[model samples]
Target: MCEQHRTDSALERHGAERSGQPRSCKPAEARRAVERAVTERCRATHTHCDPEALGDALLVASELTTNAILHGGGVTDFRVEVVAAGVRVSVSDRSDRLPVARDPADLRRRQRVGGHGWPIVCRLARDVRVSELPTGGKCITAVVALD
Candidate 1:
């Protein structure tokens, strides 16, 4: 199986919060961790989230995590928080390369290998933001609607 499927399987067995430490080993692991956290938090808070929205949240998490790994120099520390309005997934990485959405036209012209992640994130996430970390690197955050 692929790394992402492996991580997802592991998350199925484990509870939401694994070690409370950021997972940087793989993008799939990071994405699964965020998804698990969001699922558990939604259950705990009794938030009304549809399956499609939850799937979108997971997709956004995966995209952001992949962006962080491929462009932001891997993951450092990350957190997923569930608020009243929605879920927030934040990933911190060692690089300060702020993510940007590639123009669709440019993508079609250049035929980039992997420039669609950020744009997918923009569509799936209700809000997206990035901030420089105090110690080092940067954090990319995405907020997904709860319901």
Candidate 2:
């Protein structure tokens, strides 16, 4: 099994790791790695996640990683874990700026075209959360349901 698969198995069995948890990689490369990891993990665990949902997972991961690099200062690390209910993706960056959802009206009116990534992620993800990383950064996590 690949390292990603091992990490997923560990997470499913033990919840989050105690330390040195998230696997680190470059933001661009990590996005694709996370998508594949999530897909394989879901398949191995007998969860049914369609291509669309998997695509959404990939897109959200890309957006979050992009945000971390562009606005959140840079990517510190990220984790992709398979849970009993769904898969969770967390990306940590060196900024504390909380991600915000853009107004739907603005999105529809094309008043703002650039800041819709977080809102789109919120809409596609089953659950979204943000927390302060102890190592001087912020972590944004999104859960994508297997159902």
Candidate 3:
């Protein structure tokens, strides 16, 4: 129901590109980009974008950008686009370490705190990818279904 991002030029297209250090690219900014794209781009082409799906897309963007800043040493680059399949959000960060998904209940069945972002992204997005950048870092791309 979603398409994976095909090229790296998307960050350039959105004009939210950053590298090494985050210039305060907050989660709200990324959500706004997704909202704008889904509203303008889909409306321009007369394509249908499901509201629920848009919400999922925005959450994915938030989780990615937030994770970048909190864990990956800030957001290096950000991109959002409304494709035919759905909305695509890509976030680049300064860490090459892949995001690890921890079970909510560990071996002792103890409930964890504040580690739900990765799981939320995985559940909401139809396509998720992690690619190491050539300049040192990693980019995570997620696509949410519009229908």
Candidate 4:
């Protein structure tokens, strides 16, 4: 169970750790990972993939990874998998701050700046959790239902 998953990006991320290179901080890479995992799972189970659900999951993935990079001091780690409930996305980063959603409308009823990501994630994901890592920093996990 401790065996490392060896996808090309996984290899790259693992290699980066050994060489003191930064882990993947790109949201694009995270989305790709989620896509591959969910799509492959659907194929394996002979399940019809839900396009809207997949899109929501990908958007959630993108929001989480982007938040980790923009606010959590880059992505320390990431994982995506298919579970009975849905597609799960997890992202870790070197920050203790939990994600917060700013009010949609601020003083004078004007929109806020750059605070929509967290809310979008919450709306799309069926479940969201943030945990403190023993090694420091934090991990955020979100489950988006496929059906």
Candidate 5:
């Protein structure tokens, strides 16, 4: 696993407070770690983002990480960043398959136990992106606004 620590620096400026690591994690563990990372990033940045926003950010992070762990085979990398607008969480995994959200209407039609991740993520995040990593896997990024 690849572990990384990032801070505000001139040469390697990320324009935000951020930290990331590439590692394998189970669904439950990933959720806990994402929540912890969000807390740490907020404290480190000295930014008291809206409490509700923070909670939603943590939830979004957990959902994304869980999806990566369960659907993408394994979580290859995870990142949390405090940006001007809000917090951005990115999850990378071994699978190249992109995530799809079920139609909201269809979801009500079927009383299933699962498959609600991407839809919830889209609702909570200000912006969401999925891109193909050059090395074969895919990465999903979601941004939650502070306001």
Candidate 6:
């Protein structure tokens, strides 16, 4: 795995390495890499973060990565940062189309096949932001609390 350590900084970013590659196009692979990275780091350092919160982080990662692959034209990069308050995840994709949050009630009434990921992320994350990349596409970042 592509490990990064920055003792001087609170926000330390790291990548998932596989076969000498840091990026993966597949959503499942991306999600797995993210979960693995965070879980391993927490376990190795014996962080006080709760297991349930970690599970929520994994769910958020899966939702974001799936959205990126299905609508964002594949994932370009994935990064997880260790912060003072919690873990931060940033996902980069090829599409410029930003995600729209649909009302849960509306979704239930309309019977849509899929439209819940963004809303779910919003509910679970602390500071969620989406930035437009100059070259094209957008980066979605969400911070999951340790509690």
The model with the greatest TM-score is 4
User: Model 5: which residue pairs collide?
Assistant: none
Tens digits of lDDT, candidate 4, 4-29: 11233444446522234446657777
**CA lDDT of each prediction against the hidden true structure:** 0.69, 0.72, 0.80, 0.80, 0.71, 0.72
In candidate 2, residue 51 scores what lDDT? 74
> Which candidate tops lDDT?
4
TM-score of each: 0.73, 0.75, 0.81, 0.83, 0.74, 0.75
Residue range 35-68, candidate 2, lDDT tens digits? 6776677667676667787777777788888888
Which model, 1 or 6, shows the larger TM-score? 6
Q: RMSD in Å for candidate 3, one decimal?
A: 5.6
Q: What is the lDDT of residue 45 in candidate 6?
A: 78
Q: Using TM-score as the measure, what is the rank order of every candidate, best first?
A: 4, 3, 6, 2, 5, 1
Q: Model 3, range 1-147, lDDT digits (tens) per residue?
A: 011222233444665433343455788888887787777766665767678888998899999999998999988788776665677788999999999998898789999887899999999999999999999999999989878
Give the least accurate 10-residue stretch of model 1, judged by summed lDDT. Answer: 1-10
* Candidate 4 Cα errors over 4 Å, as ranges: 1-22
Model 1 segments more than 4 A misplaced: 1-25, 45-48, 105-110
RMSD of each: 6.5, 4.2, 5.6, 5.7, 4.1, 4.4
lDDT of 5 by residue, 28-57 (tens): 554455455556666766766467887787
Error of 3 at 39 (Å): 0.4
State the weakest 10-residue window (summed lDDT) of model 3.
Answer: 1-10
Candidate 6 lDDT over 61-114, as tens digits, reads 888888887889877767776566677778888999889976655634766668
Which window of 10 residues has the lowest lDDT sum in candidate 5?
Answer: 2-11
